[model samples]
Target: MEYEKQTEHKHHHVGYGTLILIWVALIALTSITVTIAGISLGSYTLFVALFIAAIKSSLVINIFMHIKFDEPIFKVFLIVSGFTLIVIFILTFSDFIYRG
Candidate 1:
């Protein structure tokens, strides 16, 4: 019970400065994404967009959602989730490529 209470009271607060920096970085990434979209990178375009989006998502998950400050189990869950998503993407892409 005490352990539960302690865990419940644990709070991770992100600083305003850090949040502002993150916001700025996110905006810059968005701008880059837009600029890239307008270009004809062809085969590499999807990879670039997904890479930037993944970075933005990780930043939001770690800092804004405080996932980094959560319990180890949560981190484990995140890892498993990410792995599953990667596998799914790989399989889907493989099928799309091979079907042609």
Candidate 2:
């Protein structure tokens, strides 16, 4: 019996323009985060910073890290990790709230 040869597939490449755009977006978000930090938003400051950080991280992971083009397992792992982080944050906040 003859075995069939597997063909190599080419992966999609991200253009420099797209990378530059993402870089600019990340810079803008960083600036916004810094500006928000300078102002007194009371208890919402951390939340706002974390929210911006989450966005920046997502962009980096999906684009720069090529997670967007990776397999479904990678995407599933990303979601699971994000969910775990959320749970950890919630538990930490709850502990802080319950502390005397």
lDDT of 2: 0.86
TM-score of each: 0.86, 0.86
Error of 1 at 57 (Å): 0.4
lDDT of 1 by residue, 1-100 (tens): 9856655565435678888999999999999999999999988999999999999999999888878777789899999999999999999999977895
Count backbone clashes in candidate 1: 0
Question: For model 1, how big is the CA root-mean-square deviation?
Answer: 2.2
Error of 2 at 8 (Å): 9.2
C-alpha positional error of residue 40 in candidate 2 after TM-score superposition, expressed in Å: 0.6
lDDT of each: 0.88, 0.86
**Tens-place lDDT digits, model 2, residues 3-100:** 11211121246778899999999999999999999999998999999999999999999888877876679899999999999999999999987999
**What range of 10 consecutive residues in model 1 has the weakest lDDT sum?**
5-14
